[model samples]
Target: MRQGKVAEPVGAMVIPAQRGGVLFAVGGLNGELYVNGQALTGQWAEELRKHVPELSSDLDRLQAMRAEWLDSPPQDRTLALAGACTDRNCHTTH
Candidate 1:
């Protein structure tokens, strides 16, 4: 584990089944949320929220969107995330 980081195994939870076919797991590291090894934004909007409730509604929404994009061809995934970031003003540098 990384310094000042916490990891929670989401393996027991079935992501795809619960979130419209998006497979992912939640992990907390350095007060951050990671889903299936990738850092999550909408799911981890706040650091404090990480220790509290499950944020199921937001998670479901993000997961559904992710599933929709993942269902697209590999080359399209980048485009999808990029578009989302732009729309959300995330300003991700990629």
Candidate 2:
């Protein structure tokens, strides 16, 4: 949850992280994206855009999703993802 690391209900999510992979930039969730700890500066961001051409559009979508998630009232599950399990692998009781 902090610094791109999910430290709860441990599983595969932590393995790559433990090995120094950038799982995700937490700031991206807030619209200000980053890679590792540094901001995705203009030059570097362009370099990344070459490989991920839709990055800009995806960020736009992310903002919209955020608005819905934060501004809307409670909603039902899109899929039966909730279940009583400590970890994801065992969370199949939909």
Q: What lDDT, from 0 to 1, does candidate 1 have?
A: 0.37
> Model 2 TM-score?
0.29
lDDT of model 2 at position 48: 41
Q: Residue 12 CA error for candidate 1 (Å)?
A: 26
lDDT of 1 by residue, 38-84 (tens): 55555443432343234444455545654554344233333333333
Question: Which 10-residue window in model 1 sums to the lowest lDDT?
Answer: 10-19
Tell me each candidate's TM-score.
0.31, 0.29
Q: Candidate 2 on 49-84: residue-level lDDT in tens? A: 454453444333333443443454223321211311
Q: In model 2, what lDDT does residue 8 have?
A: 25
Give the clashing residue pairs of candidate 1, or none. Answer: 5-30
Model 2 off-target regions past 4 Å? Answer: 1-3, 6-54, 73-94
**Number of clashes recorded per candidate:** 1, 0
True-vs-predicted CA distance for residue 93, candidate 2, Å: 15
